[model samples]
Target: MSKICIVYHSGYGHTERLARAVERGAKSVEGTLVRTLSVDQVETHWSELDGADALIFGTPTYMGGVSAPFKAFLDSTGSRWASQAWKDKLAAGFTNSGSPSGDKFNTLVQLADVAAQHGMLWVSLGLLPRAPGPDGLELNRAGFFLGAGAQSPHGAPEVEAPPPQDLATGFALGARVARAAVRWKIAAGQPPTELATRA
Candidate 1:
């Protein structure tokens, strides 16, 4: 089976929601194992990453960059990088912030940089934005996104959220990573369906 690891840090509940949305997308694929961990938890069993076929990153953008906690987690992977343990592994990232343009893309670039340092293959969200307005009632329709560059405006308890289209975007991105990983494995002479099964 193929294993995908999602590692992230959410200062508030917002980023965590994004992580969950990403996971929802990843879990939709069959035969694929999805594991989630926080930056703090990753330090205990860093080797857990070795079993992963791909790594999906998540973090809230802060001060024009990724949150410090997530950066700390990325820094902890230096040992793995030196050993080339994650080389050629599939990688992807997602970010959230209060402002629409909080330089979230910079965080994605940083994520790619980290993957590159580890010699991992990074995946992009090939899915396009949903058209015809938000999905459903449009609650949280603007919050969820995949492949980085995501933002969610502050909302009240009674206020609407990012909307459904954004969440679907996240879901598609997760599926894209799984599919891409399958292709990568096939290119590496591995079985394409080794880790895909219906839920």
Candidate 2:
């Protein structure tokens, strides 16, 4: 099975909720195992990332950029980049904010740049907007294409924010990445095992 790691930092829980939705979609893939890692705990679970087939990054947008802590985490991966440890790995990202256009797209761009520096392949959300779903919600209400974009109320609980549409977008992005990872491996004659695990 493919192993997918979701590394994130949630300043106020909003981003973490979106990360969970990403995990749900990845785990739904028949031959994939998913793990969520907080940036603060990266050292403890570093091995999981080293062995992952794909990595989905998440963070809350702050000051039109990735959170400070998450930026630190990305910087901390310099060693991995130098070692070429994650080269060619599938990479994707997600970000949360309090406004519909919170410049979270910039955060996603930063993440993609980090992945590129590691020689990783970036995966876009690949969702079409204005495609209505249940409850008349469009597939990507926030209209993000590079990655998932979610908006939570300023001080509201995440469950009551990010809206159902945004969470669904995250879920779809995760599933898309999982599928791509499997395909990439198979194309390389490295069919995944039936089971995978993480710390």
Candidate 3:
């Protein structure tokens, strides 16, 4: 019953779809409860975030970084930082854009910085690719599996959607974060199946 909170800002509906995909993956884990919140929603009760076992951040890459709304949410986390409220919690981030190389890493790095400031343990995508052959997608490839960058044209049809592979990658990352939180709780002398390992 560990809790995984996914906080994200989706400029277009595409990112929101990705957030839901991540939520699906988190909930797939046994004994895990998943909560998905938009940045606006989290802004009102971010202190409650301190109660979650892990926080998975998501955003649509805007001009090479996070959207303005997500940045606003991050700014408000200073209060939590002042109190060290998120210390030792697990954190991960996902970013999506309309190009294959949309400076997604910058977004992830920004999220890592926030987690570090809050004293949380940050987790990378740490994904293995599902390419067809050994010479296929390298684990270090730009868009392996942990983080995703969709490649639809700026105004493509909604049905175009993110690449199935990218969506799968986001889901995997979410599950990994939740599982990591479960392990962190266990190491702290709590049962892994417990809900909300708040600091």
> Top TM-score: which candidate number?
2
The candidates, ranked best first by lDDT, are 2, 3, 1
Off-target runs (Cα >4 Å) in candidate 3 are 129-141, 144-146, 190-199
Error of 3 at 105 (Å): 1.2
lDDT of 1 by residue, 141-198 (tens): 3342336455667665453333345555666667778777777766777545656553
Model 3 lDDT at residue 66? 87
- Clash count, one per candidate: 14, 1, 1
lDDT of each: 0.74, 0.89, 0.76
Candidate 2, residues 1-199, lDDT tens digits: the string is 8889999999877799899999998987888989999999998999999999999999999999999999999999988989999998999999999988888899999999999999999999898875566677777887888999898977655347678888888888899999998887777675445433331
Residue-wise C-alpha lDDT for candidate 3, range 67-167, written one tens digit per residue: 99999989987778999988988888888877777877787778888899999898877765453312342222344443545444576685456656566
Runs in model 2 lying further than 4 Å from the true structure? 156-159, 190-199
Report the Cα lDDT for residue 130, model 2.
54
Candidate with more favorable, higher TM-score: 2 or 3: 2
TM-score of 2: 0.91
Query: How much is the lDDT of residue 124 in candidate 1?
Result: 77
* RMSD score of candidate 3 (Å): 5.6
Each candidate: RMSD? 6.3, 6.1, 5.6
